[model samples]
Target: MTTPASSPSPSSSASATPPPGIPDPAAPPAVAGDRITQDRPVPLLRVCHFELVKVVSQWRTRLLLLACWIAPGLFVAAVSQQSTLPTDTLFGRWMLATGWAGPLVVLGFAGIWALPLLTSVVAGDVFAAEDRLGTWRHLLVAVRSPRRIFAAKALASLVVILLLVVGLAGSSTVGGLVAVGHRPLIGLDGHLLAPGDAAGRVLLAWLCVLAPTLALAATGLLGSVALGRSPMGLLLPALVALAMQLAQMLPLPVGVRLALPGYAFISWNGLFTGPAQVGPLLIGVVVGLVWATAATALAYALFLRRDFTNPTDGVPGRRAVTVGVLPLAALLAVMVVTVRTATGATGSGIDQEKVQRSVATAFAHLYRVQTGQLNRPDVTEAQLKATAACDKGGSTADPEGSGNDWRCVVSWHLPGVEAAGTALYQLDVTTDGRFVADGDGPKEVNGYFLVRTPTGDAPNPLWQFDGNVELLPATPKG
Candidate 1:
């Protein structure tokens, strides 16, 4: 018999009509071993390494790093050749006198602009460059997660920033030491520092800038992820830095100023003084960390939600406004509230301690300079035996009140006079630390005057009337 045509084998029938969810043996495999291996998630460390390699391999990155390595040396060389000191900056007046001052000057300049620009070289381009090259898709595919890719790029940028900052600090320190001799540093407190101690303080000062620098890098990265254009990314962060610098110059409330990044940049000045005060430095650290954290988080969110497939699908306007305007508004509101609340709590009076310290320091420096002009090496600040008791508006209870009326009874011995004389000062002091005073002392010191020199090339000098003839009734010392 036809043998029932040997009904198609069950295996053949099953192959022809495979059950649901089962692979067709007759068809090519759905996934090859090579593809399975290729599709495996990349380790985070490996991704970070790849990004770092990609960044380091770029010619521009190499060039920028080279610039960072050499710029400080060139700057120091140029500054060393100058005859006039840059008295406008901290430690600038003493830069020519000691190598220790060189780092301070360089740090001041870097804080103003250089650090931001240098950091932006990598940070501003790290994320935007991928978009410019149409390589985001490839990077995402390899990393398997957008967050991982963003993190890798951001970490790479941060690494570059750290390297650049270290390079700048090292180069500047070495250049300063070489160009200017490593002599004892004269501190802001007018005390001398040993060479080793000075070097250590200078290094510490440089290290203090690390937080602000990282904040700037994070800001640049945020701009890169948000703006998506290399030039805009670079320009925005630099502009923000510049704006903050300008804001620091404004007469804003202390709380508002402390919130600014520019204030953090100069906080290292405390390290150069005797009995270093770390309050501002700590505040800077907190501000920097907050900024870096917020910017990085926002950047990661923006990058994650970005539509790489549709390049024209611009960032949503609401999202942009929320990201850009809301935070700024909140900061401003907080600042206003802080200022208002603080204003009500603060007494309308001068800080007697601050005033005393300022006056003492100012008088000492002035006396020292005046004596130097007269070639009186014997008349030292200590030998003057200057002591003062200050009173504001005839009341010690409200020393914080703002006014032009202040008085101080100062006792000091003049250069050639054996007997110590007492003087009463009719002082006009401003809240901004400016003072104009007329002093009355014993008749023996009528013509004795102190010459006040103005900074820069101005030849005009004023003779300060340090001694007056009339003595006032003694008031109770506060």
Candidate 2:
């Protein structure tokens, strides 16, 4: 030939080697049955599967799952060996009374710390780790579509969190049952739930918490995308959780507190009550959905627009903070205002009638349990006909607000007794529609801190009781 064959052009050279997930159009055709060699786009599910495999292959993920499975066992054993129970927890005081309490107590503790930390560890690192490793470009080259990649990673992170929750719940429940022995659990409404019923409730309670847990995970995902650093991503959700906890303790309006994502963590408390309240559950679901939706959408937007041209892009620390904080703050403020407007002031949540009704219902249930404990004839709640009148604080203080100072006088008709019995209770009411009533007893009926049962001395269900009133707008009577 007159001239040597022209060297392959740079564009042609690049075209010869297509990215991993993308197929080569110039390749020879494969056999009809060989679909693997065909030129086609990768499916979203396949991408998600690859991401999940990548996550599960990591050592930290394996360690996390193992810890989730083992930690609850250790907690149950430790509490069993101790002289003191974790009375501050929702079911902690009943540790010795029923084995089921172990799972519930562990659940309470997990909501406050364990779940958020565990969720963040995976979600927070998922995307940022690639950035840290200078592999984001490589990932982009493989997948070609950032939206598909984001969806896969987000779905994979959710699967990981879901696995963790299942492991923790199963471990705590099975371990508690095996170690502590199955016994009736004292319901939050001052009644006893059989072992089988408590088990169902406990599992359901764990399932209920998944909403907030996932919302927290989505938040971590947002942090991962914005910060582009694993550590910052890991800490963001945890910091947010800490802030929410502090805010919950403050004198915030009922609706405002209900709208916060953290409220979902403790919303399962209503499930343990005799007449299970679903209002808090509904609020928790709504709040969780709002948070998850906002965080995930923001993260998706950030991921799509991220500059993959520079692998070593300097961390946009200040910009990330602005991008992350402002939107979230605006969303929260809007939610708070809307909820407050819809539900009125905090005072509307805890009124005299609601408190009185709640107290009476709790007392009636506990009195039935007391009679059963003393081997007295059985009495139905209808026969008891309980009634209560509660006064919050002295005349000098504002009558409408929630405070530690409240007195309730409860009266109920007791079976096989000529006259109705009366009991006084000192109540500490909170802004979030919860109260603790310490019975000022007639000793014989209310019993002391410990009541005599057929088996042995047990914590009196009537001595000190916790109650909640739904803070939603009152439904019209039929």
The candidate that achieves the highest TM-score relative to the unseen native structure: 2
TM-scores vs. true structure, each candidate: 0.70, 0.85
Query: lDDT tens digits, residues 228-312, model 2?
Result: 8648788888988888889777776677788898787877888877678777776787778888888898888877778789654
Candidate 1: deviation at residue 128, Å?
1.6
Number of the top-ranking candidate, with lDDT as the measure? 2
Clashes per candidate, residues 3 or more apart or on different chains: 5, 0
Error of 1 at 465 (Å): 20
lDDT of 1 at 468: 12
User: Which runs in model 1 stand beyond 4 Å of their true positions?
Assistant: 1-38, 314-316, 328-356, 362-478
